[model samples]
Target chain A: MIRNEKKWLEARLEEWVGERLIAGDQAEAIRVYQGEKPERQWLSFFGLLVGVGALSVGIGTILVVSYNWERIPPVLRQLGFLLALAGVAEGMARSAGNRIAGPALGVIWVLLPLAGIGLWGQVYQLSGDAFTPLAVTLMLALPVVWIGRHASAAAAHALVFVWTIFVGVLEPGSWISMRGADALRTSWLAVVAVVLWAAMLHQTRRLSGPAVTLLLWMAFLVFMFTIAGNWTGFDIRHEGIHFVVAGALTMIFWVGEGVLGLSGRRVADVGWFATACFLYVLSFFHHGVGIGGGLETAGLYYAAVLSVAGVVCLARADMDEVAGAGGPHVARVLLALPWILSALLLGGDRHEAVGYLANFVLVVFCLYTMHSAVLRADRRRVNAAVFVLGLLMLTRIMDYFGSLLTSGSAFLVLGFLFLAMAYGLNRGRRHVLEQVERGGEA
Target chain B: MSGKWLRLTLVAQIIFFVAWAGVEEYGRANAVEFLLETRPVDPRDLLSGHYMTLRYTSLDPEGSVEGVRAAVRLEFEKEVTVDGRTWPVWHAVEKVEPGRVGDRSLSSTGGWADATVTGSRLDFGIDRFYFSEARKEELNSLRGGSFYVLATLGGDGTLRVKDLVWDREPPTP
Candidate 1:
């Protein structure tokens, strides 16, 4: 058992004993049994220290090699690098049984090859485009990451992967530079993000703790970028298709937790938050939405296929498993509402009506989120709900009074409303939290 | 992972690096030498450390062919000498018509190499010549001044920079 699991079990056991649901002796026995079992530490201090030391050594080595001392022949320098890599590999192999030193050596094992690739570019006076070499280095590092089974090595791998993609995008003659490839480029990035998330889902079955956390965070960051791209209007010609891809990605997050056993509360939270935020942005579009006319027929077909897949996944999923509360049927409807509204906007010309409907859905979703957060005693979600509501009120107030009143009066009204809302929300949040705490105690 | 698999992975990584270096070395050893006139476009690439981005005057096409991909023939006009080294300088030839052309050799007739015509630019993949940190300022100062690049074209049409010959003596590090 992990520390958190043990703590929860202990609390449950005390509650059961107090209610006479179980005898005190039985509770004591359960406690003793759990106490005797070995506790799994999520992170080892010694392992962290070793990992940091290894990173330092790796950076120091790269610095020394990159100095490009005139006296040392390029061939000799490369040979030195090969030797160092071999030594690190040997150390890693020998320390396989050591949980701390093995992964530490693995970090060096992964990094030396990348540094060596950079050194090769420097020595050969190769093109400054780092994409090819960085891509090659990442390919080589994958096996090391899988075999090392350490969070530090996995994190390093992910960092290099992201860097490689970044460099590739910026390289001359890439897809980004080519005309009419904007939608394709955005789609490719979205696909890459999905692949990372799929990898994270796979990792959950085999590993836990920081490795999974790092992967989740990296995947989520990329996913968020794709969502942000929809509004930033990078490719206006394919705006509708971008929304389809974003909607599909959001559905994957929702379905992954509810059906695919993605082991974290944050995945579901991310799904809800992204859906709510996207709808909230759409609500501001009072005029007709300007989805471009150059919609690819192929993209529409893809969107149809994705919509079918999403519906199937949602039908198979139990939202209660994700939401951790009853009334999962209602939760499913609420989650589907935004995507449905988005599709309506895409397929029809009634943009203003759909925009108004989106505003209504956003408010309802925020209220639902607050209720769920209170039920789960999640203070963070309650605060998030309050923040979103406050933003909505502020935007609406600015819209109503911007031209109706003088600048000074408008400022005074906005300031007063802001302060009043902040005070009211704070009090409401505190009362809800107090009720939740009391319920838990009871 | 099993010890056997881990050792195999380690060996494979070493082989990957060795193979890359070995391929470049082979290309360098067998490549035929040529001279090309280049002007520095960008002084440095921060991502790949210090390197001078070179724009080949010969490879710049006359009209816009943005986003067009085709195989291009390189034609050499004359021999140029810089600091006592003489070699043929490449000139821009017409892009190869894929099916209409009968012979592949016609595309690479007497000149050094072939390059992919991508977008509006001809990519030799050797456009950037890396320099040491001490020579950064010297290279930056060579902007707008033509320099001779001693490049080699391998059998596979890959071009590698062998050396850079400046019109005047470069400053000592």
Candidate 2:
């Protein structure tokens, strides 16, 4: 979901809740975190870690006393001590909110799963039997999911999304025709896509903006699917239309919720609806090539201009007001641009039309998003960076290898694309901040 | 069991077997071997990473009597056959023999296969044999061989191997 929409949803939820009582805005956690929070409301979360670390240390001490410390693996002993420090840090971070750099610690949270993997690996270190990594990862990630739910953020959510696929969903216990790594990568990507959409879905119920931000992700996935067409049987006419339809329906679902007032939660209902409609229109356009070429052309042309504009408007949208309202306006505009443009591009002989347009637009959108985030001093700009990079990688699908898949021209074009985007983001941030400081109602 | 019950049970058993077989076959990633008879001098996507967008000679959706090889001839009304019963597909030994050098993989009658398939290879670049990874293992068990694009669209399919090269052989350096 886009930063603005997330803000909009929170603002609206705040207003709605404030209508009845006082509302807290710790990065507007309720609007974003809802069911995402962990079940443990108790502060023992850190205590549990500390306790586990202490138990490990005590066990290690006894083992050392029972035999010689030198006989045991030094790595195991070092790990126990490190675990102790991790517990201390975690405990400290939770207690004093002043010292806790909440959002500043994203990768640490993501790598938390590796700790579990490590523990299991250590346990099964002997006799060459290593079957516990997956188990440990899942176990470790379970609490992390709870932690993410408690401490709502994009990074936290992305971490959980990664963990869930690796631990909860995919099967590695059995020997399949494909290797575990292949399954892991493929399923991991798919799970991330679904989780992102789910975030969109959750956000859409309140306001449309965040859901609209998710459309870029959808575009990214589409690009990946198309480029990775070798691994997939994702013929647009056959299977891809289903995803497009589902995406559209998802948008519509949010819109319907908002219209019914059931979505009193802060969501960009209108933005979500618009994004879905755009996806629906895009599906029609791509499929239109062999099926409805004329309608597809017209639809894509309309969508491209509108969606790109929507993202720009939303990224710059003021959210301190009725945050819910901000995202829908921007989302509607953003969804229209690419889908409509794609229709036009598809109609012509533009090679890698989706890549050129989507990549260009994504870079522009990323810069704009980062600029808005920086101007607002919102931490979402970090997420905007990741999202932009993701879109950039997805665009590589358009570049041919060796020749069709390895076009050197594409790499140069993309390399500059990133550099240019970085430049633009920096420049735009200055411009927006300057404008804001000049008393413009940014 | 009564006659009707027996018949119903028999039908159910038949359906169960067919469904089981169908799923097992479809779920499996099929490994087929192909060998090129005519080596195009120009490197056809030698370093193509990931999926090289493939074009098949038998992709003439319109029923054309043209020969299957990209550049070859087939005598008109040449009856090619697969004794599926006497020689099931497992027994079918396919290799790009000298005479078979430009013969496209085709049945007595030509058509397209319904299965979606992928290829695997052993050697690097041009010297690589294009077969599914599973099929490559199958080849390891057999003698050293070449690669081919399977001409498929039938009860089973046929292999048309070409572009023979060895792993130790250098490219046109």
Candidate 3:
């Protein structure tokens, strides 16, 4: 069940208690009754352990078979693979009703199909176009994914998406001259296609939040990695195709979220906003400050164009949020401010000034995220914000210590600071919750 | 008992695995063996696992070849002496530039006849050799010099490396 649905139910129950329609004890009983029923609670803990143990054993057996593959006769080798595949299939069938073991076996079973593909590829000496085997494996494992609707199925699906992206980006081909730029474009579009499918599945209640979230994040990272590789000089002249495709995807997803009236739209919005700002900052570092180097005019022009696209996406997403929430979102405004500042500072001669401003914006954005998460009672959001803040702090400290760390004392200071940050984050979570409860806002 | 469809799917998966493996094994069992000259690549990688990065000089297509599939036939000498032993020698028969193949001359079989030229190498499919990890050191020591890959070549141009040969002999098991 979605967290929002659970919260809405709790609030209605609280209202019933306030109205005194029934005794408080009755309300409490209802709350307890409405709690999420564990799917086969008895099979949870111990079954999970057994399932994991089975997976480990399966892995060991496969490894042993593969290791002694050459020693076995060719026909026996084929027999061994068939036997192992059947063994896993039987295990999966037996545990079909088991919540823990079913998924575990499903996940373990995915490897068998992949192993079969690799085994045959080895035997027949298939060509090294990595995508072919992966595609074949995906086809082979489709039944497992279809029948096993659990974490294992989700993982198998994720592997397919990841492998597809990997093949698109790194597959050796004549497009090698593009150094994956061509492939990156194709892969990013593939991500968009998958995400759209996931979104539709989610709307139909066939896909889980974790699955959709994983797809969205993977899509974002795949695009980001492509751009990040050539951030200083991502030539839109030759390589702008992927950025345009990514930008279109970002807009489509944002619009689709609004049209579908889906929850967790903020994840996509924030991801796009963050990616935009990242590109803008990288551009400013190259075009504005020219720190560590500068880009040619064409590169700068491409960066400027991408930044505009980012602004458009952020504005549309923010407007949608405001329209729904009945007010301007402070977090959205803060996230947008950095891009504005970077745009203004673009081509400026002030390197130190822009650098400091970008750092300040990063810290503020992190705090805003953490503070809003507290007000909203979202622990995952809070953790994500804290992680970003911690990462930025570590990077900044490391940069300073790069030249200053000549002795053990500097290392000691760094270690102590890391521990202190951890402790502070724990305390800060409590303090933020208490402050929000006291009607305070960050 | 499990859901019938789930059970059916499992059985289907098993059948698929068996059929796939059976076909591959059949091909390998019937394939004719060919040898390709190989050289050591990356000392660190050679020692890292049972697998070694392999390169075949013949597979590296020289000049330009144009076509979705680069077609080259293997020219085999009936017999040749290697060291003190007589063995069959087979190598990819790459015509430096097939004039008729490039210039509007079409073959009914759609063979290498109408193929253009480019620099991309033919994927001989023998780029890697895998063995048991226990023999990591043994494989690593072979990095000392050039070696020959005794591989099976299928009718449809599939290549599988079967054994590594040094000094015109397969390394002792």
Per-model DockQ = 0.25, 0.02, 0.25
lDDT of model 1 at position A385? 77
| Tens digits of per-residue lDDT for model 2, A1-442 | 3334544766777677778565566435665575364433222457656655665566555534434433545456545545643553354245334324543342344344444344322222211112233333434333333333323334344434433433332333211112232232455655554664466345332233333334434443443443233234423323333333333333333333334444422333334334333433442332224322233333333344444444454444434312222354653445445434544443444424544555555555445444545554544343544454454544343333314323334445544554455455545554554454343334
Cand 1, B chain, TM: 0.76
Q: Which residue runs of candidate 2 sit more than 4 Å off their true CA positions?
A: A1-100, A114-138, A147-149, A153-237, A246-266, A269-333, A338-351, A363-424, A439-442, B1-173
**Tens digit of lDDT per residue, candidate 3, span A62-103?**
556645666777667667777877777777777866887878
How many angstroms is residue B99 displaced in model 1 relative to the true structure, after the best TM-score fit? 5.4
Q: Against the true structure, candidate 3 has what lDDT?
A: 0.55
Which segments of candidate 3 are over 4 A away from where they belong? A1-22, A26-112, A122-125, A147-256, A264-306, A315-372, A382-442, B42-50, B59-66, B75-89, B94-119, B167-173
Candidate 1 residue lDDT tens string, A374-397: 777676777787788777877777
- Model 1 Cα shift for residue B145 (angstroms): 4.1
Which candidate should be chosen as best, given TM-score against the real structure?
3
Compose the digit string of candidate 2's lDDT tens values, residues B21-82. Answer: 34434422332323222222222322221111223332222222222122122212222222
Q: How accurate locally, in lDDT, is each candidate? A: 0.65, 0.37, 0.55
Interface RMSD of each: 3.1, 24.6, 4.0
